[model samples]
Target: MSTISVREFSYNPSAVFARVEKGEAVQVTRHGNVIAILLPGSGPVARYADLVAQGKIRLKAATSADRARLPHYEVPADVSPLDLLLAEREEDDR
Candidate 1:
C-alpha cells in the first residue's frame, strides 16, 4: 500500500490509476487524514463469481415449470410498454 495526498492524486490521476492497474493499492489522504483507497477492480464477471461463491446470489436458469408458475398478462399489440408504465404511474399518483 502507498499513501499520496489528494492534491498529488488530482494532479496526475492517470499515473495513480496505472499503479492501481498494476495491482498496487493506494491510499489517498486529505489534510493528512485517509480519505479513499484505490485498489484494482476485479470487474463485473469476477464480482458475480465472488457473489455466487459467497452464496449471495443464485444463477439458476428458469425452467418451463418455473415459467408456468409466474402470473401471465396479455398485452395489446398496439400499446407501447412505456405508455402502459406511465399510465400505471399516473394511476399511482391519484
Candidate 2:
C-alpha cells in the first residue's frame, strides 16, 4: 500500500485511480492523518482482513445504523464552518 496526502489526491485523482486499477492500494491522508483507503474492487474481498492486519486500512468505526442516522448541528445559518472552526481555535489560544 502507498500513502498519499489529500493535496496529492486532489491534484490528480485519475493517477490515484490508475494505481488502484493496477491492483495497488492507496491510503489517503489529511494533515498527516489517514482518512481513507482506495482498494481495487476486483480483488478478493476476503483479503480485506489481511489488509487490515497489515495496517493498510483502518477498521470500520461506524455501523450501518450510524451512517443512516443524520447529524443535526445547531448553528446560525449565516455562520460558515470555517468561521466556526477559526473561532474555536481562537478560544483554544486564549
Candidate 3:
C-alpha cells in the first residue's frame, strides 16, 4: 500500500488513482488521523431484481421411484394373465 497525504490529491488525482489500479490501497488522512480510504471501485452491486429475468431455479433431476408403487399383474411361471383367464373361462364352460 502507498501513503499519500490529502494535500497531494489537489495537485494530481491521476497519480493517486494509478496506485489504486495497481492493487495498492491508499489511506487518505486528515490532521494525521486516518479519515477515509481511496481504493479501486468494486464490481457492480447485486440486487433482488436480477432474478426476475431468469427462469425457475431448480437443481434436481426426475426419478423413476413413482413407477415402482404401481400394482402389477401376477400369474404362474408357465401362464400369462390372458392364458390364465382363458383357462378359467374354458373350465367354466364345462
Candidate 4:
C-alpha cells in the first residue's frame, strides 16, 4: 500500500493509476486524513461492488411480482424509440 496527498495525485493521476494497475493499492489523503483508496478492479462485479460500497448505487433482488409491476410501452413497428426520445428532449430544451 502507498499513501499520497490529494494534490500530488491530482497533478499526476496517470502515474497513480499505473501503480494501481500494477497491483498496488493507493491511499489518497487530504490534509493528512485519508479520503479515498484506489484499487485494481477485477471486472464488472468488482465495479458494481465499489459503487455499492460508495453508496452510489443500490442493488435489490427483484421478484417476479416486481417485474410485472413495471410499466410496458408499445411503440409502432415503424417508429424509432430513439427518435421519440430525442424529440422529447428537444421540446424540453425550448
Q: Which number leads on TM-score?
A: 2
Query: RMSD of candidate 4 to the true fold?
Result: 13.4
Candidate 1 residues 1-94, lDDT tens each? 5789999999999999997786555668999996876656764233455554465764444445865897565679998877887887899999
Q: Residue 46 of model 3: what lDDT?
A: 20
**The 10-residue segment with the lowest total lDDT in model 4:** 55-64
Please report how far candidate 1 places residue 42 from its true position, in Å.
2.7
Per residue, candidate 3 scores C-alpha lDDT tens digits across 1-94 of 3456788766788988886675445666777875655544542112212331242321122134633664466787887888877887899999
Q: Flag clash pairs in model 3.
A: none
State candidate 2's TM-score: 0.49
TM-score ranking, high to low: 2, 4, 1, 3
User: Global lDDT for candidate 3?
Assistant: 0.56
Clashing residue pairs for model 4:
none
TM-score list, all predictions: 0.45, 0.49, 0.40, 0.46
lDDT of 2 by residue, 1-94 (tens): 6789999999999999997786666779999998887877676433685676577766444344755795555678988977887887899999
The weakest ten consecutive residues by lDDT in model 3 span: 44-53
Residue 79 of candidate 4: its Cα lDDT? 98
Backbone clash numbers for all candidates listed: 0, 0, 0, 0
